[model samples]
Target chain A: MAKLTMTVNGRTLSADAEGRTLLSDFLRGGLGLTGTHVGCDTSQCGACVVHVDGQAVKSCSMLAHEAAGSTITTIEGMANADGSLSTLQQAFQDHHGLQCGFCTPGMVMSAAALLAENPKPTEAEVRHHLEGNICRCTGYHNIVKAVLAASGQDVSGVGIAAE
Target chain B: MYAFDFVKPGTLAEASEALSHDGALPLAGGQTLIAAMKQRLNAPEKLVSLTGIPELKGVCAGDGGVTIGAATTHAAVAAQAAAYYPALAALAGQIGDPAVRNRGTIGGSLANNDPAACYPSAVLASGATIVTNTREIAADDFFQGMFTTALHDGEIITSVKFPVPQKAAYAKFQQPASRFALTGVFVAKFADGVRVAVTGASESGVFRWTEAEAALTANFSAAALDGLSVPADGMIGDLHGTPEYRAHLVKVMTKRAVVAAG
Candidate 1:
């Protein structure tokens, strides 16, 4: 085992991770920050997306030791300091963005990264940016709605009229 | 994934020394290597992390061409190369996805030389130079075949220098699932001549289409490729497409690239 040290959600965390331990496993199993999901072990799925040094990357595709001395931000780090939902999280809740919620953490993280880079993304950009993250619920209608809304865009009448 | 020794070398000299060890592999971005390790496809006894070497990570544009550090991530290339080479930047932007782009490096992509990868097409078409620790190799001489490069063991790719072309563009038909090219074509027009490279279609690997290049050299337009079609015998035929289909796509994508270049 190798000793690893990194900043996660603003705290310096250390653990003994094997050479092969993935960043996803370290965050979820070793650190107890289970919000980062690993839907597909392959690199195709972005369900384990997180910010490493402010850039969004798939955790499952990176080794935990490779992330040493880096700053990592996960779904658990997105809440407001007062322990309330952040604006983006609130947007998801207000728009009913998730159903089964298995892919929410990953979706939120990807969207937040997009917003961080491109603050006012178009609906088309949101869909394009989400190509890596897969969702089996909501058909991504409200998810797109939630992202646009979080960008402060008027997402009224954006999705199908099933409501 | 099997347990292995991990070492982050702070300098290129140290990294090169570490890579000289038997069963030691250079780790960059870890986008492809880590995934291969997870599937037990590769089991290097030691992983020499090159991320700590600051000299291997940026872009420098000169009058002759643009030189990009081998370790520069695709995302960085997309954002920085836009001003100098829009077509190259666009190609980088469309690779895999946002997350994959964040972790995948140009060097790793070139070294892995995945058959369907988009970089080889650009590098070959642009006549780029692949610089290593010991020597520099031309793009035409660098890529050997699918997942193979001319790089010797223990020699690390330091940077790639691309000559500024007067006009260039890359067009690709994604495989949909992996987002890798089902068929991709890159067309570049330099002062001397036109070069065309095709990826994801050939069974032997990425190759320059002499017919397309000769035609484009005379006309430099999509209409130049009207009667040209790549032979189907050597084209790749898999679940994504048939040999004939890929052959047909070669013409279509090349024409699209020419039009886009203008």
Candidate 2:
């Protein structure tokens, strides 16, 4: 076992984890931060997306030991300080970005990362950025709407559900 | 994943020393290695993490070309390599997805040498050099076959140096599910001649389209590739696509790349 420390959300957490412990497993099992869902055991599914050292990555594809000393942000940490929904989360609700919601955490995390980098992405850019995040529900139309709305773009004619 | 001992080496020498041990593998980004481990495809006794080595994590552009550290992530290369090597940057940007791009490194991609990987086409077309702790191998000499390289055991790659070409562009037809190239073509035009590397199509792995290169070297235009066709015998045939389909994509993507470069 390797002893590792890292900043999760805003809190510094340290734990003794096995070398085979995945970041997703570490988050879900070790710390009980189940917000970072692991939908696909294979790295192809983006349900395990999280931010490590400010860059979005698939948590399932990285080991806990590899993420040592890094800062990570999962879906659980995206809420407002006052414990309310963040703008992106609120937008997802307003736009019906999810149905079953298994992929929402990863979707929101991936979109948040995109908006952080490119605040004004086009419709095509938003879709392209979501290539890794697969929604089995096939609710991509609304998800795109939610991301565009979060970016403060005009999503009126972009097939967003009426508020 | 199998039980393995993990060691984060602070320097390249230390990492190399660790790799000299039996059943030791250098871990970069952990994008491919970790996935393979989980699937029971690979099980090494020791994983020497290269992320801690500052010497192997950056991009440097100079007179001849761009030198990218082996540990430099794809996202870093995509964002930083635009000025010196736009084609390289564009290709890097299109690899996998945002999440995969964030952690996947150039060295890992080249070392893995997946038939559909984007980096090999860039390296081959640009005539890059794979620099290792021991010696520098030309791109032509570096890649041997499918998932194979000339890298000796315990010889870790330090960086890759790509000589800037006058005009170059890469175009890929993604396989939707994995986002890997169904067939990708990279075209680089230098003062002397043209180089075209086709990936995701060849059975033997990434190979230069000599016919297309000669055709474009004489006349650097999409129209120059007019009746040229690649045989399907040496191409990959799988559930994703037939060998003939991949061969056809090679020509289509090459034309698209040349047109984009023009």
The candidate that achieves the highest DockQ relative to the unseen native structure: 2
Tell me how far the alpha carbon of residue B218 in candidate 1 is from the true structure, in angstroms, after superposition: 0.7
Q: How does residue A78 of candidate 1 score in lDDT?
A: 99
lDDT of 1 by residue, A1-163 (tens): 8788999999999988988889999999889999999998898768899999998999999888889999999999999999999999999899999989888988999999999999999999999999998998889888888999999998776754354
Q: Which CAPRI level is candidate 1?
A: high
Global fold similarity of model 2 (TM-score): 0.98
Q: Give the range of the ten consecutive residues with the poorest summed lDDT in model 2 chain A.
A: A154-163
Which pairs clash in the backbone of model 1?
none
| Candidate 1 chain B worst ten-residue window by lDDT | B30-39
Off by over 4 Å in 1: none
Best by TM-score: 1
Q: Candidate 2: which stretches are off by over 4 Å?
A: A160-163
